[model samples]
Target chain A: MKQQYGIKDIAKMLNISVSTVSRALRDAYDVNPETRKKVLELTEKLNFKPNKNAAALASGSTKNIGVVIPFITNYYFSTVISGIQEEAYKQGYNIILFVTNDDLDREKTLLRNIATTSLDGLLISISSNSDTQDHFEQLMEEGVPMVFFDRVPHHIHVSKIMQSDFDGAFMATSHLIDNGYKKIAHIAGPKELNFTQERMNGYLAALENANLPRNDDYIIFSGFSQANGYTDTVTLLSLPEKPDAIFAVNDRKAVGSIQALKANHVQVGLEFGVIGFTNDPIATVIEPNLTTVEEPAFEIGKQSCSLLIKHIKNKNHEPHDILLPGKLVIRQSVKLSQDS
Target chain B: MKQQYGIKDIAKMLNISVSTVSRALRDAYDVNPETRKKVLELTEKLNFKPNKNAAALASGSTKNIGVVIPFITNYYFSTVISGIQEEAYKQGYNIILFVTNDDLDREKTLLRNIATTSLDGLLISISSNSDTQDHFEQLMEEGVPMVFFDRVPHHIHVSKIMQSDFDGAFMATSHLIDNGYKKIAHIAGPKELNFTQERMNGYLAALENANLPRNDDYIIFSGFSQANGYTDTVTLLSLPEKPDAIFAVNDRKAVGSIQALKANHVQVGLEFGVIGFTNDPIATVIEPNLTTVEEPAFEIGKQSCSLLIKHIKNKNHEPHDILLPGKLVIRQSVKLSQDS
Candidate 1:
């Protein structure tokens, strides 16, 4: 094992005082430029990097942003984290991560136990069913700046960033209708989520615009998973008057819908068109590549971080809602044209 | 916004002294059980949680672990992180994530800039081509407990937990040979990675045991991406005598190989065979399915974090290598019998 070197070693090697080396390492303005350069060169040569905690203890800012999320195994959350990481790296900040596993109790306990003083700010995507606002409001009053993204809570005056869930859902349903599918169904997420209601509204609006009567049994609100999609699609197929198209909440669910349809001997693209949101990488992996509305996950992550940093630097900065638009990626999963 | 509640407020509400409340919160032996119960009850009622920074600063234990990884955008890495997160949560520890984006310079910078004092331990999965040992050695010498997971460096005395890459490779190659494939080729990852060499050796060992002459041209060292797999398979097809089967390092490349084979009008499961490592979710999505070795990615992650915590709690603990075995998942990509 190699011996650990200390700050004094750099000072002694450079024939300078320990205070000068410390100040130079901290990039304090009082240190002379020549002295700082010499100390820095020696430190670099010796392969001794400074301890950040010590500096943070001296100065209140820890240069860390805590990110709270429900899950990371999925494509959307993971991609958003990549964007957040990229932005944090560029800004010389680190991120502390907390995963609530989409449990309300876990989320509440985690937020309550968060070490506010250790983090400069927080970026969070709340659980699907979280309804308590006391913990969040308490942290805000303590002057901890935060930004919420994707699964953001409603009516929280904090800066929030998310995809255009309603618009994307509208475009997807419209695409299905334009191709001549009058009977359409939506596989939606939990009924409590903001995006769930937003997407459902969009789907309903599109059907109304097309002068098609809405069927209450056609829309199914459930979990956002492939198995859920499969079961929902199966139920839809067994209906007296089956829907001819499906607009899923996410790609995984869409993949499930396609698989269910295929299993039932229904031609997906030609006979029963299907479309989804969030063009996850799996869109291509599925047979007859899925057409999807691609969520701007990375941009949402980057922009949220940028906005959080702004709030951290200026606590009085007003919170704003930023919604990024999603693009439709046409593939074979959806019918290009319908012929009866 | 709500008013900030502190220990003093809890003490006042309970008609107790601030020191007694602090002592009770820390579970000090001198505090009476009833007093402690009262203090905790009041704190819970007032929604007052201990500030982590103050506790950490006073006791010099942050109750946090730093996890430095290459990327979180893929299946293996993200699943591994989920395992780690589960363990960390159970242990009442928070994790700070640092992504190097698989760049050597960025990895070095992240390591150098890590705040050792802010974390009780570290769990790392190094970049593919990280050769220099100085940075890792320096951190070890500083008495920081660390555990390396998959993609660990050689010659590091630190605790390491990874899947049995050599054995997995042996199983994959031998399965192909047993399936009546006399000629086989391999698509490998970067030459510098330790696992790459181990896997290559396993493939060679299997070939040698069968008394089959090894063809130097059969082993192609490239990247781990699907594109690389496609190009490598294309190159193999153009050979004067193409191998009857292909074994890839990971599932992504296996998917690419299957796609390429199909594009060239080669029957994968019957006339030709394909096997891969890491039973990624995409393995099932690929046509004809992929029969491959399933890496214990989540187990590796969980064990690494557990081992690191042990080291953190006991500085004098001895470090040893732990390897988890992988299983062969049977799918249709490889021929089931040699009836032909």
Candidate 2:
């Protein structure tokens, strides 16, 4: 094993005072330029970095941002994290992650136990059924800078970033309508989430614009998973008058819908139609290549991190709401009016 | 916003002294059990938690573990993280995440700049082509406890946890041989990765046992992506004598090989056969479900975290090398001998 070296080692190797090496390492104004260069060269050659916690204690800034999300195994959230990591790397920050697994109790527990002094700020995406904002409000009251993204709280006046869920849902529904599908259905997420309500409203507005009669049986609210989609589609197929098209909240659900339809010998593109949000890689892998509205997941991550850093640097930074648009990716899953 | 509550607030509400409340929070022996019960109840009701940084200053344990990974977008890596998260949560430890994006330079920078004092230990899966371990060696020598997983270093004596790559590869190749495929090709990963070498060896051993000639033209080394699989398959097809079967290193490449075979009008399950490693979710989504080996990714993560925690708790703990076995999942991609 190699011997551990410290600032004292650097000073001894260069035959300089310990204070001079420390000052040079921090690029202090009083240190000579030549000494600073020498210190930097030696540290780099030895692959040595100054202790950040010591510096954090002195400066009262840990340079760590805590990210609270419901899940990380999914494509959308993972992509967003990549964006956040990119921005944090560029700005000299580290992220401490906490996963809630979409459980409100877990979310509450994690927030309650969080070590606020160890983090400069937080980036949170609340649970799907988070009914209370008491824990978050308490943290905010303590002057803990934070920003919310994607699955955010309803009334919190914090900087928030997310995709235009309503608009994307509207575009998806309209695409089906324009292709001559009068009877349409929606496989939605839980009723408590802000995006779920927004998407449902968008779907309703599309039907109203098309002057199509609304049917209560056509909308099914459930969890956000492929299995949920499969079961919901099965329920739709069991209807006396089955819907001709479906708009899913996310791609995994849409893929499930397609599978269910295929199992029942229903031609997906030609006979029935399906469209989804979040252009996950699975969208392309699924047969017929699902058409979807691509959420700006990575951009949301990058911007949220940037905004959180702003809050960290300037505690007085005003909270702002940013909505990114989603683009419609056309593939074989959605049939054209002419083809029909 | 609500008022931020603290230990003083709890004491004031309970009509107790500040030190008494602090002692109760830490479960000090001098504090009365009834007083401790009251403090715990009040803190839970208010969702109040002690400042961990201050506690860590006094106790010298940060209760944070840093996890360094290469990528998070894929299924296997994400699932592995889920396992780690589960264990960390159960142990009451928060995880700090760092992504290297499979770049050796990024890995070096992250390791060199890591805040060792802020973390109790580390769990790492080095980049695919990590050729040097000096940075890791320096940190280890500094008394930083760590455990390696999956893509670990070649010569490091650190505790490591990984799947049985060689055995899985042998099983996959032998499965094809048993199915009456005399000629087989292998689509492998980067030449420098440890698993790649182990898998190649397994494939060679299987071929030798079957009395099959090892054709150097049938083996291709490339990146681990579906595109690489497609291009590699295309190259194999261009050979004077194409192999009757193929064994891919992972599921994504296997999917690509299948797609390429379809594009070339090669009957996948009849005229040829294909097998892959890693039972990613996409295995079922592809037309003829992928039959491959299931790497114990989640188990690896859980065990690695557990081992690291042991190292953190006991500085004199002996290093361990744990190898997990993989299971072969039968599906349509690999045809039966009679069908072939």
Candidate 3:
């Protein structure tokens, strides 16, 4: 029969503790460099291949964080994942990715079927449905630390990191108004999303402060897609009272709006103004370049993962909500008003 | 141990083999609907978890496939992931993602640290470095069901899925030549990449077929990035004899080339011509809409994942190589020659 060896065996051989060997194995920053070097040399000499799962089971420290997202095909989500990956790599941790495809049923089954025993913690941006909140709550009850980013549940008392959606919307609307555009409309995301409602409130607040009449017909709720933005803009254009400017929930929708305007032979920057949130790369590619407020997608991802790791390390850590601000990026989309 | 109830108990209740019960639990397609329903009902009643690692150890099936990619922030890679995710979902498999950030050292460490015991198979797009092929060959020798995709390793007899790079490049270069651009320079990806060399060959072949002088100075090899395209274009434009057209390796680079041309007051699609491979969405957004050869990114992803799953199911399965064709998508970047 063959005998098995592990970090503990190496620790005993080196007159060290198992925790020291584990930290050295994970390449943790706190470990002394000389001790780490010694551990590595010994492990290499012994040809030790650590069984990640076995080590995780024994110590309840997996050095892995599970990230559950809705979609990765989009610019924002993928960029966010890049940020998360960067931070995870720097911290000597690995992330496992799960996609829900934005279906609540799949979201539910995925959560329910998750091997929580294997995961040290979780980071999730859910399907954005209130009904699925219970599944998240169940995960929390299991003592698995978690942090929600971007699309988060409203009433959960957990760590969360998000971009400043309302402030960015306010900035976009004010920029359009400042550019001498009066008849303004907004293309919003699905109404149920927390950010959607917050952004809508900011837009409305900006309009009310400027004493502009609010027309119910000016607000359109649709999916966060370019096609939705295009269709919504078309609907707005066909109205008897055409808007002079449009504030979009996202850049993709804004791109769609610009395309619809171009297809109709409408001069975009010279006449109709468009301001979008989330300065996607396509913002620069579109003609008359899109004016946008850049969402802190990467920062949000980094902060969320960083926060989740803190919670995992200390169970009693207090939950906090983080709202990173967004900044307006000036471009060619909005017309230059002659007067300030 | 309380006579530990598990999948075996469920199998006994349904008068089925344990493998059938496991298949039903995994939501495999061939399982009977009635049998699956019964199995689900019994499992639900028992509150069974079937601890993933334990079940995998018992049956030698983890039902998880690991995917190792370089970057997901780009359009092609993200779209490929979408295809992989769709196919994985349909086939009742979960994908574990690992990104190497295009670093050879990181790639080596990641591949070495992979928990092979917990994974059913592997899907990899190598970092396009010859040095890392040894790590892959070691995995293959260990009998790990694996498939290489897109950025494949050379000198390895393994199942692989990639777009027809040489054919696509030929189409791109020939289209430029046919449009009356005699001095066409190509800004290509890193020299070590398989696709980069293949694309370069196609460009050389097109020039040879047209009886145009092939200048060694016409080819510039650099990183796969927009910045690379911009800098390379700047160098070409500054040359004593500037090329009349530019064919870039990818759409982002094509967009960069167009931007550089337009910045220098060189009218694109009129005075100068540009063409690209990989008709990314940015192709439409870029001014003068890039003419390109669209790679079958999504198809390659789906085929690779599907092939890996077949290998996982049967270790002795024959390995195959697939090369899906790319099609030319004409928009406005290429100039219309008057004589032709």
Candidate 4:
């Protein structure tokens, strides 16, 4: 590695005191504009980087944010990241990503080893099975500003931003009922996930209001994978009393259920109805299209980051929860009846 | 904000010298087991984290790797990241991501601002239109360890890992010919990318081997998006002499072309054939189940990271060129004449 130039070296090169060079770089009013311009130009030309340790020690700020998420390979999460990136870029902050792969052990290890000294704040979406909030509470106690989004903890008194999962689910389930589908099945994500429970509650409420009999067998807890969707749908189809409609927790599962139905040579649009959450791009590509509730993933990201930065700047800021509403997008997947 | 604990606090708490505490944490042989155990217990209890900057200053290693990519929302890139994350986790390293959005200017700025002091090595996939590589050359000259994957620069003599684009393209073209497709069209990505040129070359070589006349007009240099594929396919269809087969650069574009064909009421499998690269999950959801070349994205990521780490450890190691072969996945998008 090349020898890194330090502030002392730059001071000697420019024939200035170390204190003066530092003040100039920090844009202190005590330094003349001409001197500040020269110092910046020289640093830019030499690609000189200030030692982050010394800077952090003096300023007590790292200008770095940590973002912990379960995964990043999906459209919803990726789009949310884009939104976060936009806000962070505007505020001149850098984001460091940590993925837990939805494993509680990994999440614990990550939190335990996180270098809070180097992070100004944190934005997280807890893993599916993250039942304990001790680690998060500990971080908050340490005055590390934190904000949660999407799949967040239920009882944490931190700033959180998420879509209206319950309302979205109710709309999806109600859509099925309005379309004249009496027997509807719901394919859900892991029961441990907070959003899954919220969505399930909405499904139940919609069924209750419609005065339709709720069958416990119609609600299945599966993974978020397409294969999970297929297997769950197959299991539902094999039941003694099969439902005429299916409500998937997310678009991937919905696509999988559709594929399973098509493979079994069962007419989808006419004989069966399906709806999904998260209006992923695949929803449009699937045959007969998919009717889905569009979650405001990007907005959640932008708002969460913006809120976290506020907490970082002012530690005493009050925590708030922001819930964006979801919209129902109708397509060919569900058949409309005269009752509508 | 809560005051962060330092080694001085730990030393005061244990009634020991700060140097002894640091040494014990570093697992130096000079420290006794009892002292080491005491230091570990206190550090763990207090959740004390050694300042990464100070540790890096002493050891000349940061345990951080930088990953520069053009995009992350696509299936191939996301899966590759999963592989990289798996290996990185095992090796006790953290990855810092830098996205350029396929803009050459953004790539230049990001590389220019990269802090070599904060990173042990870099893994990069250059933007499509990165015509100048001076920034990369400067980093190499400064002895920064770096490995390029996928969209690598041709002028750089560094280690590179990528799929066997040439061979994969040849197989795709040959498959079309074997299925009785005499006239074939190629919808390619940006001409500036190395992989695009390699794939195009493979297509040309296959046509030459079969003694078929190669029409320059049949090959179009578009983009790597679905909209590009749709528009390009529409243009091809409008031509007086349209090709019977199309080979898209990726799955998204292939789906777009299929949508275009279906909109025009063309018979997909019999009257026309479509094939795509990168066997994304969407391939199955689309009508007729797209036939594609499955790129080993995860393997590429793992191998690239492993190789980069090796080079970081030993600067004198010879550069390696790794080419992983892709598999031909047969599906309904392309039908053999014999089967018909």
Each candidate structure's count of clashing pairs: 0, 0, 0, 0
Q: Is the docking of candidate 1 incorrect, acceptable, medium or high quality?
A: medium
Error of 4 at B270 (Å): 1.9
Model 2, A165-222: lDDT tens per residue?
Answer: 9999999999999999999999999999999999999999999999998999999999
Model 1: how far residue B336 lies from native, Å: 0.3
Better of 1 and 4 by TM-score: 1
**Candidate 3 backbone clash number:** 0
Q: What are the runs in model 1 whose C-alpha is more than 4 Å off?
A: A1-40, A45-49, A338-340, B1-40, B338-340
lDDT of 2 by residue, B51-95 (tens): 666566656788899999999888888888888998888777888
Q: What TM-score is obtained by chain A of candidate 3? A: 0.95
Preferred candidate (TM-score higher): 2 or 4: 2
lDDT of all predictions: 0.88, 0.89, 0.86, 0.87
Which candidate number would show the highest lDDT if scored against the true structure? 2
Model-by-model DockQ, in order:
0.50, 0.50, 0.48, 0.43
In candidate 1 the C-alpha lDDT for residue A295 amounts to 97
Candidate 2 local lDDT, residue A330: 95
lDDT of candidate 4 over B174-265, digit per residue (tens):
88988999999999999989999999998999999899899988999988988998999999999999999999988999999999999999
TM-score of each: 0.91, 0.91, 0.94, 0.90
Over the stretch B166-203, how does candidate 3's per-residue lDDT look in tens digits?
Answer: 99999999998998899999999989898899899989
TM-score of chain A of 2: 0.89
